[model samples]
Target: MTTPADVHGVREPGLPGRLLTVERDALVPLLRGRAEEDFTLPVAACPGWSVRDVLAHCSSAFTRVLEGRFEQGVFSPACNDRDIAERAEWSNQRVVDELERGMTEAGPVIAKAGGVLDILALGEWVHAGDVREAFGEPGAYAGAGLPSALSLMAYVTCRKGHLSLHADLDDADEPLRLGDISGRRPPARYIGDGPTLVRLYAGRPVDGASYELAGAEAGELNIFDE
Candidate 1:
């Protein structure tokens, strides 16, 4: 099993705490001052989900993590959908308040989840991006959470397959690689900004022109979309 330290290359203590701090700071401010109509806006990254739905899902996830109620699977889109649906009647401000309270209470539990913190942080960052994009606001993708998000992407790719590939991101300090260890090298590689790379890994769309690919086959890398 990969530990949080192993998954994120954590060289210092309190990395999880720092990440939670970043998530809180980035998300809470975005929720403030949002109008009722704003909650109905569609989040491009999460098709069929309104901005309010995204908040409900995020808030539920944080609460679940705190309560030790995670689903049993690699990904749980169904459970996510259920989470949002159950909170359908919640006012936008109520959902935001729940999210804030859950995150505040989840810090210690999340920090103790071994390597799972990466995935948790990734989800928060991605949904935060969704919320920001829906509001026509710029995201804080370049913040303290970027490195951990990148690491989680690499880990997810590795788990999905063993096709060798490399990633070059404008904001990343070092290039990321996967499937190189199995002696099966594929020619195609990804080149783009860190946020775009993370979005792609999370099965979110990136404008085709925003990134470039080189090498064997692009379809081989789509496993993360599943």
Candidate 2:
């Protein structure tokens, strides 16, 4: 395995910056159209959520970030579910209002809480990928923030647990063995190119089981959803 570098406080590379901007702009419209589109979305990735539910989750995230309410990191599964259930019938104007507040306030809030950038970056890429997957876009890795994001995930998982099932890298012949770190701990594995991997490690898994590995010796990998 290639030894991962420590990019804990480093800013994302420039290419991802461009991609991030595009994704940020497109996110609102995608959320707004959640109800009308099919996207053939999987329930497992976002269980108990209709396409509208995903939109609510996004809106809640924007709301939390804008409110400067960083307590408990400003995002949680329960919070997302509540927003989805309560705001299920939100109008486009309502989404526009909340997103406007989010865009207006995100800068200062993030400036005050610099550490949250990692979450923001990962969130952007993962959600973008989710949107792309729903639309059946191929070669989704072309999206920005994916590379470094995945690198971060690979690094974190190595420390948290081990993989039992082998992962077949594109150019490599031998599959990477994925197993548990300790019998009782979670199994580890990398997902996505780099940024996407970081998103998964950060507990998003927006695409659900797309990156899941099977046939592990110790146990299965337990990916978190919040």
RMSD after CA superposition, every candidate: 4.5, 6.8
Q: How well does candidate 1 score on lDDT at residue 118?
A: 49
What lDDT score belongs to each candidate, Candidate 1 first?
0.67, 0.47
The sequence of per-residue lDDT tens digits that candidate 1 reaches over residues 114-211 is: 65554565567677877887888864355556776566556545544546667776666667775434556643588877776666555666665378
lDDT of 2: 0.47
Candidate 2 off by > 4 Å: 1-20, 26-35, 39-43, 70-74, 96-108, 140-142, 148-226
Best-fitting candidate, measured by TM-score?
Answer: 1
lDDT tens readout by residue for model 2, 1-226: 2322434224433323343445556555655556544533653346566544554566567676666556763456766667667775776457545654554455445445534343454454565565555566664434443444444333334434434323444423333433333456443444333323333343444454345433442123433332
Model 1 misplaced regions, further than 4 Å: 1-17, 71-75, 139-144, 159-162, 178-180, 186-188, 216-224
Any idea how many clashes model 2 has?
A: 18
| Per-model TM-score versus the true fold | 0.78, 0.55
